[model samples]
Target: MKFTLAKPRIFFKVSRFLFPFIIVMGVLCFGTGLYTALVTSPPDYQQGDAMRIMYIHVPASWMALCVYSLLAILSLFILVWRHPLAEILAISAAPIGALFTLLSLVTGSLWGKPMWGTYWVWDARLTSVLVLLFLYVGYWALYKAYAHPAQGIRAASLLALIGAINLPIIKGSVNWWNTLHQPASITKLSTPSIHPSMLFPLGLMTAAYGFYFLLLLILRARTEFNKRKCLVQENFS
Candidate 1:
């Protein structure tokens, strides 16, 4: 089937409208979550004020994993179907995922220093997450290394697929080993084990981050598309 510009143009037009709305909602949710986390929510009995960092740390860590997982799926789409949007999405997602991973590590360390009496630990979860960050960097590097843009996308997609093998490892690390990281709290099938007050802000923050990711992804993809267009024009000129 022949590809048409009209489809992408129509989709992007709708996305342009939706993106701003999502951004507004994300900002509002983030503001509300921050307020609740800092003031309305009671401090943890064990961790005290330090527990407040969960509002930021948990969401970042979640987004780190979530975004990489998304990249992996998009990479598979690019590899199998040669979807132009898939490659664009995967490329756009990598840097944002890296940022989230970095935030997770930093905030985790800050929260750790007070509780674990050390800033870093070679625990299963933390180590696996570190590997995830490296994977993002690796994919980004591969994408930029090749002279041909198609070759770069193909190479990066392969890296993304291979790196995804670690996702299960990251998720199961706490279960597989005696790790410093705690087991799943809110994701339990039996019950959400967190308090409602804490759960509300945590959920809000997660939603905020999701919207933020989408907003950034759209922006980056549009930038990339424009760059590619300019390069094509330059080649013809």
Candidate 2:
């Protein structure tokens, strides 16, 4: 059996139409989530207004891990199958994942200062998440260091694979070790532990963030593909 790359024209046209639609939807959802989180939801019984930060922080944390996991999967495809789209996706996803990781850290700190009486802690979850941010930076640096595109992709993909080891660690840190971080409120087999007033906005914000990440990834991938196509045309011309 043989496989060949799909024609770029098909991807370009589909992505061109899908990207803008996702962006519009992301904006609408995020805006509505923000309004509900900030104005409509009641204050926390324990933390009061400080708990509102969860609206942004939780989603950012989710995206940070989610995007990196995607990068690792895509990297595997790039290394094994030499998929051009996978390589482009890995590259496009790095900065966005980094942004989300950074937001997670910043917002976590903001929430922590009031709740934990400290801006930072050396807990398992926090430490692992910090390491995730460093992995993002390392991947970006490796990508930029190599002169040849293939070499750069290979190096960055290796880094992504290695960094993926941390994703599970991050997800299970609270369970694997006693940590200051709270365990899953939504993922348990039983009913969600959080109140409906807060959970609704959190859920909405998470969905919005997912859409936003998809929108960005699609736009970035299409842009890079178009650039590569142009470069190839120039070389041939």
Candidate 3:
């Protein structure tokens, strides 16, 4: 009995301790990253002013994909283990992932106009990303639709499971077919193709975006837990 009761509380206790650390790290990374990306990093000789857009575009794109993968993993835990913490964390991730997807699409458009000469395209990389955004929205809608909240979470988990198939397609789109989007550079098996001057800020921004996601996820899950508790009390009493 004590073990069962203590399990949920244990997760939050750890989060409470980690919360301030996450915030400090997030701020430090974002501050340092933006400063380096915007002020210190040299422009790409090829794209020049337009290349700076990669600083924002790359990190957002990365986080957008990453968050969905995380959500899917959480969904797996919810389905396979019947974990309450996983469900709440999955719920917290949906909107934030959607927002990150939006940022990536918009930034990619802005960056593309200079390189691709158009704001949008049906290219495999771009289209897959659009599908990803749709998947995020689809999960959000499904998660919120049912009157029975538990039913909704289970339904959303299935969608997350199915939708994760798109992730590999998105990552491999550049290599699988001819496309305007550049092929894997920084993520290659060999040394990263990107110059160190550009790479540092990109790394920092990616770290900033990742920690920012974690901080938001922690807060949202806590708030959702409280909301569920209040809901239970109201329903019973």
Candidate 4:
């Protein structure tokens, strides 16, 4: 079938085919990652057992940013193309992004308490992440505030667009400010500073989180699409 963003039903069918496969992959990745992270991988020289928290914290942080980036891109699509699926996808993604953002914050705090001796700090990285969480919530609120679909999405899309500015700030915060948060390890242009043993599990967990997000995104988008279709049918009837 020809894949097109304009056709939600076609997208739904494709997602249905991919769903079970994604679930299987996600489960395998999660199981293997957990075992490797908690059992096989050596603890950090500095942090010891506390370093295991990075397994969850880093992936959640990555996913939080990734999902919000997706949201911003979808918002742009909604504004420029005005595709029906764009609206469904944007609305579907907001809560998931928020969940990831919250997870990132919580896990970061858990990890930070041991190293930084504080649970929370108002530094650049942390503060920008908090702002990202608020942007996700704000987008959802704005989308729901309007009775008209077009108006609501337009307002929400604009917020998503404006909030896109924070993405860079969140990414660059550690470099820009003297935050307690460590600098990037895996994302550096040079070879990653992370040891191979730690990087292995981290990679697996990142894949697991990614697949899980895909499964959730497709399911949520499908549900939103069906709900809208039913509403339309009812109105016509």
How close is each model in CA RMSD to the real structure? 1.8, 1.7, 2.0, 1.7
**Tens-place lDDT digits, model 1, residues 39-148:** 99998888898999989999999899999999999898889889887777788889999999999999999999999999999999999999999999999999999999
Task: Give every collision pair in model 2.
Answer: none
Question: Relative to the unseen true structure, what is the C-alpha lDDT of residue 69 in candidate 1, on a scale of 0 to 100?
Answer: 90
Report the error of model 4 at residue 29, Å: 0.4
Per residue, candidate 3 scores C-alpha lDDT tens digits across 95-199 of 999999899999989888878899998999999999999999999899889998799999999999999999999999999999988898888789998999999
Better of 1 and 3 by lDDT: 3
Per-residue error for 137 in candidate 4, Å, reads 0.7
Model 4 C-alpha lDDT per residue in residues 39-75, reported as the tens digit of each score: 9999999889899999998999899999989989989
**Strongest candidate by TM-score:** 4
Give Cα-based local distance difference scores for all models: 0.89, 0.90, 0.90, 0.91
Better of 1 and 2 by TM-score: 1
- Candidate with top lDDT is 4
Please give each candidate's TM-score. 0.95, 0.94, 0.95, 0.96
Identify the runs in model 1 with alpha carbons over 4 angstroms from their true place.
1-7
Q: Residue 68 in model 3: shift from native, Å? A: 1.1
The positional error of residue 33 in candidate 4, measured at the CA in angstroms, is 0.7
What lDDT would candidate 4 get against the real structure?
0.91
Clash count, predicted structure 3 = 0
lDDT of prediction 3: 0.90
lDDT of 2 by residue, 81-196 (tens): 88877888788999999999999999999999989999999999999999999999999999989987789989999999998999989988998899999998886779998999
